[model samples]
Target chain A: MEKIVVVGLGLIGGSLALDLKKRGDFKVYGIDQNPTHVKKAIELGVIDAEISFSELSEADIVIIAVPVNIIPKLTQKVLDVVSNETLVFDVGSVKNEICKAVENHSKRKNFVAAHPLAGTEFSGPEAAILNLFDDKVNIICEADKTDWRILDKAISIFKKLNMRIKMMNPIEHDRHIAYVSHLSHVSSFMLGKTVLEIEKNEEAIFDMASTGFASTVRLAKSSANTWTPIFLENKDNIINSLNEYIKNLKEFKDLIENNNEEGLKESMNNTNYIKSILNGLK
Target chain B: MEKIVVVGLGLIGGSLALDLKKRGDFKVYGIDQNPTHVKKAIELGVIDAEISFSELSEADIVIIAVPVNIIPKLTQKVLDVVSNETLVFDVGSVKNEICKAVENHSKRKNFVAAHPLAGTEFSGPEAAILNLFDDKVNIICEADKTDWRILDKAISIFKKLNMRIKMMNPIEHDRHIAYVSHLSHVSSFMLGKTVLEIEKNEEAIFDMASTGFASTVRLAKSSANTWTPIFLENKDNIINSLNEYIKNLKEFKDLIENNNEEGLKESMNNTNYIKSILNGLK
Candidate 1:
């Protein structure tokens, strides 16, 4: 807990560095392949300084917050460098691959797979903010594989950030996240693509976008580099979700085509249950 | 200019009443098929008082904010009652049908086909709030059919609500809205339906929902009564958008299946243009 190494200076990593630094309890250092982000994180006071991967051995905690595709390799590299007492974790959207990647590593007991359920549409070091993880859910997968000391340290860090922690298997994490997170991104990107393709008049699109459209398409603004991996890594689950989504769309289309008012109404009524779920999430 | 009658006391109608009343520009009265909304509108002071459709003759302007399916009939009734100088407008999502329904009316010149592009997911009088139309867009379709004085009065009213007005053909309005507005509802509802079907563990779904999922699925909370008719009325355009959306999803799926890194990256990069479009909308 004395020294923390955040290995990605993007949104999640940068935010964690800022929060940890503000606590004045840990010396937070950052490492990123992107030199610009590392420099920016230092300049913005997000971290005490930029450190090398070699410094990983001295860190009490190592957090991998890079893209999902890069996370498996990065996690293994960090586990290689960090001491057995150093708790290592990854804040990846998809976790099963990363979990399996290091499941047999000698330092497996030091690594925890986590997904912090929080983010805005923006990215990069500048996109980071204080208290981003506050009051958010942090999902930890394959927790039983981690040593009790490492697990306790991860829990304490999340609690310090005011996050509620939940545990589940990696496979269940991927399946549920596909439905809840990954599929929503696809829906939003397709909605944006559909509107952009059809609306020739840019002025009209800009002028008439109501709050509903804006909110629904917000995730379409997310970074492609970040998302392309998440979608591909969790391909099977995402594809299954997409198939079900398209089927639901087709059923709704039939309802509209046949003017089955009752069926359409019933479908929407059932979907409106999302209100309660959202209320509960909040 | 003197008296305004708003039919339907739901979100759109109630909000219009609140904005016009706050301007102190008109004596605004409300009518709703639902007695609860009628009571709530008066209770919330969203309207001056409840009035019958028979009172339309005395009003200088009448606004129709009913469901899309009821709009054509309601517009016909309003056109029949209002004077030649009295401006009549409907804020239905689908405009072509309402425009066509009143095409042969004697007072067609008094009716301006409009769709004020603003609303929250919540509905009914209780959901109404002040400044709901402020800085929002109001699409006036088939404006050439409305008499000059009526059109000017309609524009003035929307201006008083702090709205930016745009002119469009009724056909174009319905088509564009199907892609931008209507399709968003379907995508969101289907996403909700798909997720709810796959994840019976509500707590897990709720726990994993990030900001992206929450915003993209927000529209699923909309009323079925409000959206069903909109989807049905603009059936062709919605189907077209859904078809394109499904096609895009399939392509994305294939790219993932083949591990076509280049294809996946390119598609996401292209869709990244949405960031610019969204920025412009904001």
Candidate 2:
């Protein structure tokens, strides 16, 4: 059987371990710096065994699922030790930095710079869920740079996990993700902060925040450990998205101020096209 | 059976009529200026009968479920025609404007200024859902001004709908709701607008906007007919919240620009309190 070593056993890694084990295709070894996560993942049956970096050469595959800031360095380290036959992939949210870091590496063609755009607000091995990557999008950036054989292996693995594969330039992936994913997290967090700052009376806010507020702020519950590096690594694109979002917010505020009912209705109507688009526009 | 007339038979009115009829307490009649809404409500059994505004005198209870912009006037008109025993309430999102509209009226004591914080992103009679008010918050603003007997009737009705009742001054309700509810809608709408503006590739945006973006932008799918009036009716308070929200977004952008990891993590950590708070904060 093929041997797979998963580093950073958080939600993404731990979950990958669980589902991968069920496939009966590989023996998955877990590696996480956090001692608690390693023990918990092993106890939870998320991994077949806990392994160290020194043992990485034993594996045919290495999956790096750490936060974005740590991904580039970790991917480089894994590439340094893993044999030429071993395939390495990083599943961080941001792709640019890690892809750039590994671009000039001797084993660049052996590494598949990929991101599985899938997760929950929860984090760590304890938060690992089953079949998380099932039917989700797995983006492989700069696929042409990866060795054809290695890329084929990566695609087969993602397909076995039931994911749809898309290929794009690393730079384009970072730009689009900043708008779709990172900005939503930031907007949710700040909305939560703005409400928290104002509503000192917690119960009252809770009552008013039942339906709409809850859905709107749901992403605010996401882990700081996971998100900090994403916002930092993708700072440029995030700032650009934020600037556009704020400017639109200000225009909306002005429309409300002037009782521009037509303007408000027009904007909202225009945006309602999202309803159809959200029905999984293909 | 006692008579209850529900004005503007849209989602709230239609749903309320359905649930209220299920209680077998009153004969629920619906009146909507849109003939289509009235026809649909009756077709769906959301209302027992269609009635004219002139027939309101026969009602023992009156619910004004019109859009916020028309709520004050329609509520006043109902007050003009209802019998002395009639208990009138407006279920608009903005309470202050509607509450103030009848503050000095001769029938002021007969009206309860209320806002039931419940709804989905969809709208119209077709969107009316069963038991929507169940386990949701129903705010009775300026309750002291409502006649003792009338307020009891309104509370009993809401209780039958399984709502938890809370009371607050109308002005305070408007201010807080702007931050909790209206601000969320604005944030969602503008977020949608921002992404829609940037992603010229609609299909690509849809693929990336699967989970997190979907939740954050869901409210942008809300009916413009329903929300335009809400943002306009609560303009003052909405503007205040939006201003604070815009400022926070700018500060966050600056943090990202500086790659302030600590600052970014701190903001996200603080906002994570929303997770517990959302679990029905004590």
Candidate 3:
């Protein structure tokens, strides 16, 4: 692609712009509602220039990396402006909403709904870094809805970024992601809230936070603006995941309450199976 | 300190042995119900030799680093066999039971109760490494019950390991640690369990586990042997923390269900305060 436009110059968008620009294969421009982010993206050399939505007409590729709540409308607007040959895709956490929003659009064939499963607790333009998408999984939902050429372009770009690709239906993608990714954020945030509520003395937390607590609560630091929409947009799956999580927590509580040492040991032993799964031993 | 006996040569005990041995100021010996750990500690140079409980009489310091359920009884046994000048201490996660168990002993003055707040997800003698306790906090409980000289010896040894000391009552320590340390473990394990249950394809978890999930679930990989007793021993505090944590999760769920965007944003915004707290931004 000769020209590319990255919307919402935040962690994913900014990082993509930086990497694409560094490769010298694409002329990268950024579009953000936040003027500060637009300015910072330029100052940080994340993009070659700032461009308006109208510039989508000249772009060979357009990437929407906005929050899930706004991704649908943004994707639609980009689709309206892009040329027939231009490939438009989103890096949203939730896929079903955006996929359905543009399913019937005239330029639907140009839009590919994608979710790149990679991020840190940090957010915003400055939080972006080089090669953030390297060796990560990029899930493309409803791939059949997009034209073959558009899908090929996205596959080529993501592969160039060293990402592995997987294809799934939008509904299935949302359900699985809600359990694995979104639920983790909820558990982490609540853990932080619970501990901070009880330990009013901040030094106690600072002194006692082992590597385990630090790692577990790291996601609690993620931006509220970024995650609120994700949890809200993917409400049904999130609620289901939350209900299951609460059930597990209650079962554990009951085991502890009854002093069922054997039962508690079994519960932990089963969960410790996570070690092998996480380590890819499974 | 001339000679030290480190009971239960697992992560904490083994790490302590390694640090002390590195100093070349003490001759550290090992004891564990697990012969594998005892043998490994010797092989890893974590201890100079493996010794029986009967050898406790020769040690100037007796460090009990066993699982919480075994700690109370083992601590009392160590106190019974140690010399009056010996500084005996238990590094169990929960401290109240161990403190109370030795409260009426004639040699109570020889015992110090401590919880060193440092560990990795891994376990056993093979998991031990040098300087694990460096700059970590060592919480000493019920110090007044112990002889001042014994307390001084305990403090000096931790200081030599480059650990800072904090003093608190066992009850307060248990309550606070249940929130900061214990709750994180439960949340992480449940997260791992929930994800593993929902995502039947283990490859999805391995492929999509970003830095956030990896860090958030890091504690789930910890040994069940160490954590099961901790959950049971500090059952009340853990239950209380879990209750609060579940309440927070439910509230978040409700907000998402109602599409109460403002509430979701506020809750996450409040929890985001952890960012500053964790980074010591304040």
Candidate 4:
């Protein structure tokens, strides 16, 4: 069996490993800098075996599922050790930094920038759920820079996982994701913080919190280790998105404070269009 | 059989009618100013029959499920016509206004101030579902102001629906709910508005928006009719929550803009406490 090496045995990597192993072709090797994750992943049967960085030379497929800040350097390190025929990809939220980091690598064509836009708020090996990637979007950036055969192999794998593939350039991918994904996390974390700060009685908050509050602040539960890097690495675009969000919030606050009922209703009605958009997504 | 009249046949009212009807001892009557809701509610079997507002005089249990701004007037009207033995309640998110409105009414002791603390994003009778109130929190504000036997009747009915009951004063209920429930809606609406503003290409957004964005923005699709009055009626408390939310967002924005990595990580870690809180709620 061909070896598929997965770095970072967290939610994304472990989940991908579990699903990929069920395909019954690749010998999945799980690797993580955190020994506990590596040990726990092995105990949970998330991988065929635990492997080391030096063992990557035999990997036919190398997937990096680390934090965004670690991805660029790790991608470079993997490319240095992997076989010439290996297909390498990094499943990081922010794409520009890693894509730019590998832009001038001699083995650029062997690497693909793949961000499988799938995850839950939970992380670590125990959160390795089956079918997590099924029916989710797998965004491939800089595919034109990858080897044709290698890209085809990656496509076949993603198709087997039941993912919808959309190809975009790195800049467009980063910008859109910064707005759609990263900014939402920032908003949720701050929302949770604000509520937790103001509501002194946790039980009172617990009693009053409806499905709406739970859902809106859900992403605030995302891993700090995973998200802190994303907000920083995608700082420019995320900051722009946050500024826009704050401006809209300020406008909403002013409207609410002044009892601008018309403006408030109008804005809410417009955003209700998201109902159709979300339905379409479903 | 006791007659139970539900005023305002929206999601909460309609769902409650369905569940209450299943309990097999009450004749449920649905009433709404919107004739369409009444008609659709009848078609959906969410009600036994449509009743006029004047019929509240004969009601054994009268529930005022209208918007917060209308609840004060509607509760007063219901109290005006309710029999001495009638148990009147208003399912409004903000309790202070309505509680205070009916405080001096001759039938004040007959009225229970309840906020069921349950709902889906969709609204209207069309959105009604069976068991929507199952295992949910039913917050009764100013229970002391209500008659002993009447509060007991409400508690028994809520118990039949499998809900947990909590009692709080009107002021505490409104203030805490402003933080937990109302502020989430504002944050979500602003999130949807922000993304909708920045991502001009809705198709791109539809593709890249993951579960996090979807969950965080889900409340953005809530009924404008239901929410406008809420934000306005709870203006003081809601604005306080909004201002705090905005302040947090600004602080987050500053951290990202200035590359304050430690602050970013610490904030996210702190907010991740919500994970445990949410898990506990489950």
Q: In terms of DockQ, which candidate is strongest?
A: 4
Segments in model 1 whose C-alpha atoms lie over 4 Å from true places: A280-282, B280-282
lDDT tens per residue, model 4, A1-282:
889999999999999999999975889998899999999998999988988899899899998999999999989999998888999999999889999999999999999999998999899999998999888999999899999999998998899899999998889988999889998898899989998898778777676666477878888888989987888888888888988998999899899899988889999999998887878654
By summed lDDT, the worst window of 10 consecutive residues in model 2 chain B runs over B202-211
Q: Top model by TM-score, which number?
A: 4
What are the lDDT figures for the candidates, one per model?
0.87, 0.89, 0.88, 0.88
TM-score of chain B of each: 0.97, 0.97, 0.97, 0.97
lDDT at position A86, candidate 4: 97
Task: Write model 3 residue lDDT over A37-143, tens digit each, in one string.
Answer: 99999999999999888778999999999888899987888888889999998999998899889989999999888888888888899998988888888999988
Candidate 1 residue lDDT tens string, A1-282: 499999888999989989988864999999988899988998999888888888789999988999999999888888998997999999999989999999889999999999998888789999989999989999999899999999999999999999999998889989989999999988888777778887888776677678477888888888888898998899999989988998888888888889999999899899888788778554
Query: Candidate 3: misplaced stretches above 4 Å?
Result: A280-282, B280-282
- In terms of TM-score, which candidate is stronger, 3 or 4? 4
Worst 10 residues of 3 chain B by lDDT: B273-282
For B1-282, candidate 1 gives per-residue lDDT tens digits of 488899988999899999888896688999998898888889899998888878789888888999999999878888888777888889998889998999999999999888888898899999898998888888988889888888988888888999988889889888888888888888888999998898899887677776477878888899999998888889999989889888887887888888887887787778778677667465
Per-residue CA lDDT of model 2 for A17-62, tens digit only, reads 8998998579999999999999999999999998989999989999
Measured over all alpha carbons after superposition, the RMSD of each candidate to the real structure, in angstroms, is 1.5, 1.7, 1.8, 1.2
Q: Best to worst by DockQ, what's the order? A: 4, 1, 2, 3
Candidate 4, residues B188-275, lDDT tens digits: the string is 9999998998888887778777747888898999988889989998899988988888888898888888888898889889888877
